[model samples]
Target: MNSGRLTNFLIPLLAVLLGVIAGSIVMVISGYDPIAGYSALLYGAFGDSYYIGETIRQMTPYILSGLAVAFAFRTGLFNIGVEGQLIVGWLAAVWVGVAFELPKFIHLPLAILAAALAGALWALIPGFLKARFKVHEVIVTIMMNYIALHVTNAIIRFVLSDKSYKSEEIHESASLRSEFLQSITDYSTLHYGIIIALIAAVIMWFLLEKTTKGYELRAVGFNQHASHYAGMNVSNNIVLAMVISGAFAGVAGAMEGLGTFANISVKAGFTGVGFDGIAVALLGGNNAFGIILSALLFGALKVGALEMPSSAGVPTELVDIVIALIIFFVASSYLIRLLLTRVKKEGK
Candidate 1:
């Protein structure tokens, strides 16, 4: 890689290393063996085919959600409402899946499309508000999260559910589960959603890096006044960016509803996946391939953490501490850059 690319890669890598070190310190302070804890964690995530399958399954949504946050970041929009978008998308996808009867090809795509459109429409509200009324997206998105949660819950209870806390299971035709994958992975929940997530990543990369519209969006992000003066429609680009970001988040919800769960439950609280996406995007440096790798790391950490208490006599919560430390280091990257600069100067 070139110098710039190398630096970009090194920053996050070093942050991860530092976070690991800090976590080990915390484990020691807590009277646990960090080595054993981490070993168990790793084994739980990748030591067996079953674990590997689960890790990949967990990674699917992380990839899409990371893409959602990263897309908005690229366009100078803070889409804190990905959680809301994902919730509504999940509801829409499950509603379509349960309410429809069609061939697999048609049914599946239609459900996924419903999710995307739901997310897009939900996001359009904040986008429009920001574009037309100069409202800050952050406040609107945060409130929208609560709205999405309650609205989805109400929909499940009153409209989609048979007086239950969850919607009916989706039809088989709308499912993303693959028998071949299940058999190979010891019947884990891994599904074809990974393929969709990968494809979405590619699309984001192409849309943001290799297109005229992408350039215009980036330019608006860099300087909206300049972009407007240069004859770009700044307001429209803002709305488009949020819509696309919401679509990615919506697909993330579909990965959960159609692939992992096959139904939508009335949530008592947020799923946390959307919030975690912010950390994923930050750790990934908002790059497409970087987000994939970052999501993989997070997925493994989460899956592996489940084994810590059982195998190493460590609390599962330690993993959360480690993850927080990692994000802290990533967020403090300015210090890391300074350290790198010092090292280079000393070497020279």
Candidate 2:
């Protein structure tokens, strides 16, 4: 890699390293063996097929959610509504998966597409208001989240036959199950959804780097006034960017509802994948390839945390603390850069 590329990668890598080291210190101070805790963490995340499968299952939605947040960040938008978008999308996908009967291929795709559409529609209201009325998107999106929650709850109660907060199991045809793979992984729910997530990431990268539409969207993001002066439709681009971002978030919901969870439950307030996406995007520097690694790290961290309390006698909340430290370090990268520069000068 060139110097600039190397430097960019080094920033986050160093941040993560420092965060891990600090976490180790915390473990030591707490009277736990830091080495043992870390060893257990690694073993829990990658030591067995079951653990690996679970890691992948968790990573699947993370990839999509990371893309969702990353894409919006690229367009200079802070999309805080990913949580609501994902929840509603999950509800829509699960409803369609259970309500429909068709060929497996067709049914599955339809359900996923419905979820994407639902997410896009949810984002559109804020996008439209922001574009047309000059409303602040952040506020509108936050409010939409609550609206999505209550609206979905009411729909589940009155419209669906099932009075339970949960929807019925999706038709087998629409489910993204792989019996052969599941057998190999001891019935872990990792399926074809990983492939879908990868494909979406590739498409997103291509869309951002090699398309006129992407250029227009980014131009508007950089400066709406300049873009408008240049004869570009800034308002339209802003709306379109949010719509596409929401579509990505929606697919994340579909992955969980159709591939991971057999059904959707209204009582399940939020999966938090959308919120996690923000951290993923930030840690990854909003790059497509970076997002993959970031998502994997987070997925492993979560899975490892589940094993920590039982095996290492460390609280699972330690993982959150580590993540927070990592984020803090990343956010203050200038400090790290300055220190590195001072060390280099001293050596010189």
Candidate 3:
């Protein structure tokens, strides 16, 4: 890689390292052993087949959600409604899975496609407002999150009047489970969704870097006025970027619905996956390959945090603080650059 790409990557890595150092300081203040806590963390994430499998399984949705946020950010659109899209998509997938009686192959693909469509359509609302009426996507999408939450709950109540909070469990044919994977992972919830996530990541990278359409989209992201002057349909690209971004988030909902949960439950609040995705996107430098590694890192932190309190008597909340610090550092990368530049001058 060139120096520019390498420097772009180094910033995020520095953020991670600094976050860890800050967490270590917190551990010391709290009278805990930071070394042991991190040791437990590493072991919890990779010590056994079960732990590793669960980490991968948890990261499956994370990968898709991260990609969703990254795609929108790269296209210069803020997609705060990934939470809304994910909820709607989850309901759509489960609704199709249980409502239909088709063959396995057809049913499974149909359910997943339903999720993608639901997510895309939900996102289109904000996209339209931004494109046609000059509404800020951030504000509109945040509002839509609440709307989606209530709408999904009301629909669930209307459809499954007996079960007030959730839909029926989906059929086996519509499930994303792979018994072989589960068995290999000591019966963790790992499934074929991980495969789908990997494929999606590859496709996302290819779409952004290799395609003419993607080039147009990036141009619009860089400067809508310039892109319009260049004869690119700036407005359409806005809508299209959100649509593609939401489509990925919708598949994330599919992973949660069909693979992890096997049913859609009524959530009292937003599923935090979408918010976590924001952090993943930032940490990944809004790039596909970076996002894959960032998702894995966050996934490991979450999985490893569970073992911290029990094994080392350290608070799991330390990890949360670390994540927040990482995000803070990343957002303030100018400070890091200034420091680096001063150090280089001193050396010279």
Candidate 2 per-residue lDDT, tens place, 138-190, comes to: 89988888888888887876665457776778999889878877888778878
TM-score of each: 0.96, 0.93, 0.94
Candidate 2: list runs displaced more than 4 Å. 327-348
Displacement of residue 105 (Cα, Å) in model 2 is 1.5
Error of 1 at 304 (Å): 0.8
Per-residue lDDT over 1-348 for candidate 1, one digit per residue giving the tens place of the 0 to 100 score: 897778888988898889888988999999999999889989999999999999999999999999999999999999999999999999999999999999999999999999999999999999999999999999999999999999999999999976789899999999999999999999999999999999999999999999999999999999999999999999999999999999999999999999999999988899989988997898888999999998999899888888889999987577678667766776676688789978888999
lDDT of each: 0.93, 0.84, 0.88
Better of 1 and 2 by lDDT: 1
Which one wins on TM-score?
A: 1
Clashing pairs in 1: none
lDDT of 1 at 264: 96
TM-score of candidate 3 on Cα atoms, chains taken together: 0.94
Q: Per-residue lDDT tens digits of candidate 3, residues 131-245?
A: 9999999999999999999999888877844657878899999999989999998998888899888898998999999999999999999999999999999999999999999
